[model samples]
Target: MRFNDVIMALLVIVIILMIIIPVPLGWLDFFLALNISLALTILVLSMFVKETLEFSVFPSILLITTLFRLALNISTTRYILSDGKAGEVIDAFGNFVVGGNAIVGFIIFLIIVLIQFLVITKGSERVSEVAARFTLDAMPGKQMAIDADLNSGLITENDAKERRKKIQREADFYGAMDGASKFVKGDAIAGIIITVINILAGFMLGAFTMGYTLSQSIQKFTLLTVGDGLVSQIPALMISVATGIIVTRAASESNLGTDVLSQLFAQSKVLYIVGGVLMLIGIATPLPNLPFITIGIAIMLSALRLTQDKKELEEQAEFESEQEEERDNNDIRKPENIIPLLQVDPIELEFGYGIIPLADPNQGGDLFDRLVMIRRQIALEMGIVVPMIRLRDNIQLDSSEYLIKIKGNDIARGTIVFDHYLAMSPGVVEGEIEGIDTIEPAFGLPAKWIRSEDREKAELLGYTVVDPSSVISTHLTEVIKKHSHELINREDVKQLIENIKESNSALVEELMPNLMSLGDIQKVLSNLLKEFVSVRDLVTILETLADYARSTRDVNILTEYVRQRLSRQLSRTYFPFGKAKVVTLEQSLENMLMEAIEQNENGTFLSIDPMTSQNIVASLAQEVRKLIQMGEQAIVVTAPIVRFYFKRMTEQSIPELVVLSYNEIESDIDIQSAGMVSI
Candidate 1:
């Protein structure tokens, strides 16, 4: 039900109770009935208006009763003076207030007391439940997204893991602290009982003192004292009613419940009822001394309880507010704690050795070996979480002259591309190129000079001759994977092509099919046959040359096996450097990068230096030497270094394209340079 409706319903019930109650019954006075009616009506209005039960309504009730008591005192004085039993009448008035007022006020106050108590109890409960819901629901959903990214290689798994743990720890700490702050239950009721005792004490004392003092001073004065005390009870009575409404409302708002103790201590109605009883005792009882002291004591007790309850309410409000703020924080991880976990860039590599064709025997490597070395070097240095596409290529391989999507120092990248051509193939001539050579000297080979096989192999490996910027979505994990897979397959196909090129197919073709329409298949078969014959002939020749009589079966077989393996090895060797071995490079790179960062007194972080291809290659070679020395596998760093900084390094301070790791570099580390494979 609406709050307004609920309050109206409560007021209606109180009004009905008031109407049915016998007026002036037993010791009840008509004036007392009128006072009860006024208190109840005002309380109902207060509730309906939504005034807070403790602070707002209690203060109002106190002021109202003070006014009512002043009026009552004047009326009693007038009545006593006119009656001619002025002294006797005045004394009787004190007796009437302490005894009769107490009885009548108690009866009437009960009805107002019940209604205020009920409304406040229910309201505070609903507020607390709503608060709990607002704090705990959305955290896990956000964490799931981070988990998926880490698993898919879209983000570093280590970074995601740390972020998740940090969130969990924070949540645990918040929960524990919130639980510790709730108020102790049942404390409110003890407060109310104390309030009642205090009121009784204050009223009795005031009544006794007034009667004794006035009686000693003068007979007429005694009458006047009794009359004034009776009137004074009215304000106390009214203040009691106000206190009752406030405590009741506050308790109800606190949601501590209708437990007798909590209700008594927490309910404002208890104070109001106590106040009313004190007033009645002061006015109706013949014991003038006891009522005043009792009521004063009761007023003090009620005030103390109200103060305490207000503090608890304030505390609870603070807790709920904090819970709500935490709910808001669930949407994003704290940048300071978790932002460092995401990859800054997709791919980064340093290419060393000036841009040149791979087939140059003078440069000391086959085109394919140089390409393989380049890929491995990149994988090691950048933490290869994403694929590095070759932005520059030797044109004799019919590959794009530049690799697209390479992220590294521009000078290093260019020099590496130049070195690739100069060193990879035999008979490739190198010349100083204006644009290619910046701080570092660089050389490039003409396209025609590169072997056709080398060109085919380079193209197969996804080494585009275009600039690195041309590749779309370079940082995306899926795109890099797709490109890497294509390159691998291309390399495989090129190897098969090279096998066909060097074989003596004509000699083997004598045993192959003579179909005109299936020439491609025939050629493939002829190539296969030549490979088999060469293996067979070499094995047969080795067996015949061995001294069979002296040689044991094992020795004879080992010699034949060695000859066949040598023939196959000689045929397959591409890059003069060596076969490119793939390793798990990420751990090593991370360690190297962290070490480098720490080692720098200026706090400069490293990235793959993008310029000076030879420097890029040399830097990679240094990192590879370290990794090889440590004997660790190389893995890729999926995010590129978008920004890095060192404290006190340079005026710019930030490091971008810092060289990370070098690993598995064959003894001939200079053979391959890592290129900046840009994100």
Candidate 2:
């Protein structure tokens, strides 16, 4: 179809024909020249390629060229056996290249064959096999690294995909090379066989059929055979060398020639030492000192020039770096640069200088990797996607301190001693160990900072030993759990709805904008999240809201209905063993709150007197303390009508108290009244 494609097809046809048909001496010379030219071009191209992938088509090209050379060898053998002459190309190589001696020419051809077969071909084959094995072995590790970078927000999804594709391509390239090296090895063996056959057969045909004497036949056929062998073996040698170069080359940004020159001559000091050594040898020996002295002086001058060039390059790089820094400073001074500072990361971690190694991968720290796992864990447990956390260094803080922030406000801060283990008492210790006393930043549990060597001793004493990074990560996890509701907004709600719409489109269309708006649903979900309820079961929550939304527009009432529908989930979270220890209000206090519910346009409020409100709060606080003392959760169970008011009235004073209505408890769970509050 295209010009290059047509030429390639025709060239392949010609190579096939060369093996089946006879060629004149003139054409044989031309084909011999073409073969040599092709081999030389391939050798040069291999030296200039930046990486193996840049010349991915080389394996096919190698097979084609090897076949073409073998075909030419066959055609030249035909002419030599029948006529005792191949072509000028072969004759010139036989006479001029080897001084017109058949013995010398044959010896030289044997040397070329030995070099290509034993050295280049064998070595390249082994290297290709090793490279293929290593590439495949390292594939899993490279894939995991890419996934870690993607999860940590260091690279985008597209970047991770591209990296994975590149790794696969490298593996394929090395595998192809492993198989391609065999072609050159086989070609070398075939060349040896063809040369031996041509010499033996040529002698027989010339002495018997052509009627020449045995000596004359030997002389004439020997020269023709040696010349043909040399013509083919020289090009084969070049190709074998090229194959070795391709397989041995490492992936670099520069071509092979540039890389070799730069690395080999990088240090001028080595050259100067060598030149001095040569001059001393010349002076010590009784040889001609002038020759060695002249060469040494030239080497010394080249070294000096290289040193000057390296210095100029370094100076140029430094000057460019300074100019770039100045440009950045000028850009920072502009008012437009201040706009970015106004926007805050949804979640952020700021560390002091001493703790910087905890986030640096080069220092054997896995903080970033741990953070990626934390996000995945939160999604599974809380049914919410946590945004990428921005980690940075804050020089204003103490060297051992770090802080976690939400919406630009610090929610949790902790101090850790680097190069030490935090040994926390696991409720019981067999004996006391020598260490610095401190508090576990996540739970305020008493802990001791122990030396690295003391970790085993502390663990043997029944204490939980944790590293500094783990301690900080645990604290950050707890803070995120506490502030999850604040992190979610209307956009998150819309995303959840859209995800559900994929499987339940009709349900979403019927419920949204008809019975309630998106904001209304956001409020209901937010209310559920405030008490650590996972809204991952959006189908159930939305169905319940759609059923009750038409009767009342109150978000609190709708959330209560959703909770009742999700009683099994809530019961499992609070009472994993199917039993709940709760604190109930007395009948008189419940009745009093029920009567105080005054409804108006702004919604219902508790219209109780000051003494009544104070007594209610005081009695609940006393009961909460008793539950805490007994190591039981403080849950307040009341009538559904008064549950909202009761929680709203005492939420500020007793935030840890969980207020649940009778309808919100699952029927199968066993309920135990641990305490009762009376006003």
lDDT, each prediction: 0.36, 0.86
Clashing pairs in 2: none
Cα RMSD to native, each candidate? 31.1, 10.7
lDDT for 358 (candidate 2):
93
Instruction: List the candidate 1 regions with Cα displacement exceeding 4 Å.
Output: 1-142, 145-191, 208-477, 480-679
lDDT of 1: 0.36
> Candidate 1 lDDT, tens digit per residue, 238-308?
33443334333422434323344565666666676677677676777776847575775687578667878
Stretches of candidate 2 above 4 Å error?
1-17, 23-27, 146-168, 213-215, 278-295, 313-404, 407-679
The count of backbone overlaps in candidate 1 is 160
Which candidate has the highest TM-score of all?
Answer: 2
Candidate 2: minimum summed lDDT over ten consecutive residues — where? 145-154
Worst 10 residues of 1 by lDDT: 180-189
TM per model? Answer: 0.19, 0.58
